[model samples]
Target: MSTPYEVEHGVTAGQTGRRPQNRRVDMESFFSFLHQISTDAISSVSSETTPQTHNNRHAEATPVDTANLFRLLQDQFATLRQTSPDATNRDFLEALIQEVDRDIADLPRLHGVGQEFLDGLDRVSKKEILKGKKGEEKCPICAVKFNEDPHPLVVALPCHTSHCFDLECVAPWLQSKGTCPMCRKNFVRKKEEKKELKEDSEEEEEFDNMNGVWLATGYPQTVIAIRGVDEKGLALVRNGVEVL
Candidate 1:
């Protein structure tokens, strides 16, 4: 009888499974090339203008500006796609090219999750993801079956249970839009809103503390007055009256 394949929990693809050395090498090289392209693109952009200046220009950016940025990113990916021996890398580059086009579609309103949010995304193992009774699951971006890849590093968005995607496929999308591709849910913005609410609550509490204000139970009408004295041993007064 064939031995039952055993996979661990919360581990990446190549960490445990029968992943080939060539596939591992391909993965590493693909990501490294992508990183280089990103660095070059960002460096080129920085040479022309700072981030703040770029953002300001985006509001009034002409077609030429958009085209130049698009060309800069697209040309890099095209070159990578040409030199890459692996079909998977070419597929990823194709998807990324689409993302670049979409991003340039609306430069002024383009927003995405930052590196902090991306790093904080939850990674899940193949066993952790509950598959459907249907056919093989494929990545929405590259349309490649997850099972086909020997080392599929999948990430789960906080949006839903079934909202899982290949890390490589989803990273570019999240970095471009900060929303789930399947659900269109903006988890990053939701998180920021919750944080803002908590901050506002803290600010209100601090303001109350500074003013010596307290909520008294069953004494809504009770008046607890506060008076402040200056360094001169005199009441700090305002508008010709003693400040309470």
Candidate 2:
């Protein structure tokens, strides 16, 4: 027998709790179908001819100022997220931030995004464009092979060289003087310092039970639209409040 509740909701009593996702939903196919529908709708709307038909379509459809509405929402979300860590324990904010970063960078390849994606990231965060280093690139301070990870008290530098110092080994030393011990190529000390300081600050700012959070500003429009994205990022924030 069909219940009044089930009937109102367009479902039969027998179908209750029988969600496809719970049982045998092919998520990939579902997503593909959704994508197909979206692309089709977009094409239909865009290809519509004549101002009259366009106007009629606009009148018939629900009105939504997508751009402005998105901007407003994003601004609100960014502020709330930025303050989450400071106001609360921080677990909420850190996850949100990472999610935002990842989402911003990733776009459906169907969209045909070019190198423009790389252009959106902050230069300080981008991978150092690797350049070829010269002969037997021996770390001046440590004198070790160039291809492996640095050992304790050994600091790795550009040019595939290792100096016997950790980030702390040469952070201050490099901060004051921006040159690698082995190679004179300018080392990015300020950026590294800021990163280290931020991590430390995040750790100290909240208890262990909470996630570390840091507020960042100056995200690009693309970043806001896609979500928080940078080199290392996630899809979305957890609970609509935190990123992880």
Candidate 3:
């Protein structure tokens, strides 16, 4: 008959069965060994791949324009400071906001001139534009044939040669430039004429200062003297009064 310990542990009567204390210790050691192997493998993989991944990320990174970025940051910070007065960094924020505001105020302001210039241009019909053409006239703005286009809105400029443009095309352009696209003539005729007259007066003043007093001699008389005095020192006389 088999002993109780032998039957329970599946050991022979002469062979000893493993103690419970030793069995627990062996199981702990086996688990510890497995955990250590797993840790070592993970460490090895990380050490091998980490440098290469970091190098790739560094190589692919793009450089930023720091000056522009700093300016943008300063503007945003100034705006924030304006909105929140009780926040920190009061002095620096005030200075930055003041500088931005000064720059904005220094820019030239255009008022009612743009709208008035656009309104002054003559709006003409497509039939008037193509009055003498044999169905071959094209709009200078859209580059489309007048016969083919359904819309009939066209604007004629007051240029010496009378250049016409499509209303839709020239309206937006006039708001900003206020000039004819083809001839580059100013839409505000009176303003342009005044400017030219002022420039001419300035030039005449400069010329009068450089030369002696021929102030009373008109432009026609001056031109005649210039032509007649081809080889002599011609003195201009206004009403028989000789000017040196």
Best by TM-score: 1
lDDT per residue for candidate 1 within 100-176, as digits (tens), equals: 77667655232556546765677665554345321166555444456665545666788985676666556555644
Q: What lDDT tens digits, residue by residue, belong to model 2 across residues 1-244?
A: 3322233235543554422221111122222222232221211111122211221333221112222222222332344443342443144334433433443444311211112221222221112212234223432322222332211122354434333332312332232224543354444454467789999988775533232333344764322122344567643443355444
- Taking all chains together, each candidate's TM-score versus the true structure is 0.49, 0.17, 0.31
- Ranking according to TM-score, highest score first: 1, 3, 2
| lDDT of all predictions | 0.51, 0.31, 0.40
Best by lDDT: 1
Query: Each candidate: RMSD to true structure?
Result: 12.3, 28.9, 38.5
**Model 2 lowest lDDT segment of ten:** 108-117
Error of 3 at 182 (Å): 1.6
TM-score-superior candidate, 1 or 3: 1
Model 3 earns a TM-score of: 0.31
Selected candidate, larger lDDT, 1 vs 3 = 1
TM-score for predicted model 1 compared with the true structure: 0.49
**Candidate order, lDDT descending:** 1, 3, 2
- How high is the lDDT of residue 212 in model 2? 32
The CA lDDT at 205 in model 1 is: 73
After TM-score superposition, the amount by which residue 164's alpha carbon in candidate 3 deviates from its true location, in angstroms, is: 0.8
For model 3, state the Cα shift of residue 123 in Å: 2.7
Global local distance difference test of model 1: 0.51
Q: List the residue pairs that clash in candidate 3.
A: none
